[model samples]
Target: MRIVEEPFGKGVVVKPIGRLDSTTAPAAEQTIRDALTRSGHRLLLDMAELDYVSSAGLRVVLAAAKQSTAANGRFIVCELRPQVRQVFELSGFTRIITIVDKRADAEL
Candidate 1:
């Protein structure tokens, strides 16, 4: 997976492409944590190019969500593909995490 970091309005945005599985979940988690440490909390994950995500990926997402909440920051996922969306919904992550259908929607 490739993680591209972008600066959003008041936070850091992470755009990850390719597959997010056991092999890549740690990298993703670390990337977000590093951003939080360096950039001061708020974060948004743009997942438009992401093709696949495993349970491990979900775990990383959950961890980030919890961290954001604890730190009084926001962590949102945007532009998820259909497959990834299904996984999130089936895993009941949709209820716990903020997910938007479009990047613009998330920006709002």
Candidate 2:
């Protein structure tokens, strides 16, 4: 999997371009952690190009969200494709995390 990181005035946008399975989740999580440490957790995960996510992937995302909360910053996941959205909804992740239809809708 590939991840692209973009830093903006307010936060960083993490765009995962491939599957987020167990093999890829760890690296993604590490990248996210590094970004958080540097930027204080104002993070936006742009899942527009992500194709898949496993339970391990979800854990990484959850951890990032928790880190953001602990840092008193924002974590917004936006532009989830239908399949990924379904997985999130079925796992009830959508209920616990802040998700939006677009980047503009996210509270960035």
The models' CA-based lDDT, in order, is 0.87, 0.88
**Regions of candidate 2 where Cα sits further than 4 Å from its true position:** none
> Residue 30 lDDT in model 1?
95
Q: Write down the TM-score of every candidate.
A: 0.94, 0.94
Using alpha carbons, what is the TM-score of model 2? 0.94
Task: Summarize candidate 1's per-residue lDDT along 1-108 as a digit string, tens digits.
Answer: 899998886888889899999999998999988987665678888999999999999988898889888988888899988999999999999998998877677651
Candidate 2 residues 47-75, lDDT tens each?
Answer: 99999988899999999999999989988
Q: Report residue 25 deviation for candidate 2 (angstroms).
A: 0.7
Please state every model's RMSD to the true fold in angstroms: 1.2, 1.1
Model 1 lDDT-worst window of ten: 99-108
Decoy 1 TM-score against native: 0.94
